[model samples]
Target: MDEKKAAILGEIPRLRRYARSLLRDRDSADDLVQDCLERALVRLDNWQTGESPRRWLFTIMHHLFIDQMRKVNRRGEAAMLPLEASEAQAAPAEQVESIASREIIDALQAMSPDRRAALVMVAIEGFSYAEAATILGVPAGTLMSRIARGRDELRGLLDDAARRRAIRIVEK
Candidate 1:
């Protein structure tokens, strides 16, 4: 494969991860990633040389996700569903991780889409502020504000969950 094609292909996992974080449903996320890849491939010639392929692909995914959200909102459909446990039994360590993961997912879902997207791009994906801003199509200042607010909101959500869990433990 050419360098450009190889670079695009290498970004699939990151794109999928971002999509999954945004959509929260495995099937929907996969569909979104597939759509993004198809679109990127079809418009490959339009992509400027010397630009970051990962950022370009993420921008595509972000726009698609926003479009999907708008459609769901127009239809008055609920965007998120409760997280469900897998059927397989987990070991103790796995179980702990699963519970913590679910808590974090729930907290993330509680955030506004913009804030959640900023958090995912910066904190989860480890993108630089400028790079994330480019991918999100927002000013660097706006992106920074969103990240700050998202972190605060996420902190509050997690803290509340912890308190609730503590209450349950105490009551039991």
Candidate 2:
């Protein structure tokens, strides 16, 4: 494949990962990724040479996600489905890891979409603050603030969950 096409194709995994985190449903996330790819293909000409394809694709995905959320809000529909146990389950040897992962996912779901996106980009995806800001179409300072607030909120959510779990264990 040509360089441009190859670059775009290489970004599929990252795009899907980000989409899955945003939507928390495999089918919905796949659909979102498909829509993002379709839009990117159509606007490929507008993409500048030497630019980071991953960042550009992320920018497209971010905009599409925002637009989709707006449409759902207008229709008064739930934007995300509840996390399914089957989807969060992992291998026996990694039971603890699986529980921790589930807790983090739950915390992320509780956060505002904007904050979650910023955290996912900077923390999970390892994007620089400036790159994440560009992808989200916000200033660097704004992105930093979002990440800080997101971390604080996520910590609180996890702490609450831990306390509830402790109570359940104690009551047993």
Candidate 3:
């Protein structure tokens, strides 16, 4: 494959990972990745030379996700947070870590898509604030606001979960 194609191919794992985190279903995530790759390939010429394709591709995927969300909203379907189904079956020794992980993911998924996208790009994908802001097509200050609010919301959600878990333990 050519250099452009090679670079785009290399980002599939990251794309799928982001999609999975957003949608919480492997099949949907794979489809999202495929759609992203297809769009990126068709618009390959639009990708500038000597710049990182990661940001460009992520921007495209983010738009697609927003479109999908709009469609779901129009249909009156409720947006669901990713459930910790797999973690629920963890062995005794792994349960603590599993529950913690589950709580974090649930909290993240519970966030508004805008906040979740901002947080994921900066925190999980390791994008700089400027890059993430550009990718999300928002001003730097707006992106920072989203990130700040997202962190606060997550802390509250996780803390509540911890408190509830402690109550359960105390009751038992």
Candidate 4:
């Protein structure tokens, strides 16, 4: 593969992780990543030659994710079962960690896509605020606001989840 193609290929793991975090469904996330790679390769020339393609590829993915969300909204698609109903049996030793991870992901899923993307890019992906803003096509200030609001939203959601869990334990 050419250098540019190689660079794009190298980012697949990051893209997949980001996509999974955004969509919260492995199959859908894989499709989104595939769509993103297809678009990126087809428009490869549009990428600036010397600059790193990291931000460029992520921008493409963010745009595509938005488009998918819009299409889903218009269709009023059916909802899938949440993680709890579909969760597999894990080893007892891993249950607590698994539940905690699922709670965090579920909270992320509950956020609006814009705020979730903002949080994921900056906090999870370690993008700078400015870089995430540029990738998300928002102003820096807007990105910061989204991150703040997202953090608060996550806290509230997680707290609610914890309370529910505690109540269940106490009721037992």
Ranking by lDDT: 4, 2, 1, 3
The TM-score of predicted model 2 comes to: 0.86
Local distance difference test values of all predictions, in order:
0.83, 0.85, 0.82, 0.85
Q: 1-172, model 2: which lDDT tens digit per residue?
A: 2888999999999999999789755778899999999999999998999899998999999999999988887886654443433345443453344667777777787788899999999988999998999999999989999999999999998898788779979999
Q: How far is candidate 4 from the true structure (C-alpha RMSD, Å)?
A: 3.5
Per-residue lDDT tens digits of candidate 1, residues 55-115?
Answer: 8899998999888878887886644433232222232343344667866877786678899
Clashing pairs in 1: none
TM-score of 4: 0.88
> Each prediction's TM-score against the native?
0.85, 0.86, 0.86, 0.88
Give the alpha carbon lDDT tens digit for every residue of 1-172 in model 4: 3988889989999999999899866778999999999999899888987766889989999999999888876786524434343244232453345678878887888788899999999998999988999999999999999999999999998998888889989999
Q: Which one wins by TM-score: 1 or 4?
A: 4
lDDT of candidate 3 over 1-172, digit per residue (tens): 3988888888888998899778655677789888888998888888887778898899999999999888877886644322433344343453344677777766776778889899988999999999999999999999999999999998988887788789989999
- Which model is ahead, 1 or 2, in terms of TM-score? 2
Runs with alpha carbons beyond 4 Å of true place in candidate 2: 79-97
Which residue pairs come into collision in candidate 3?
Answer: none
lDDT of 4 at 156: 93
Candidate 1 yields a Cα-based lDDT of 0.83
What TM-score does candidate 1 get on C-alpha atoms?
0.85
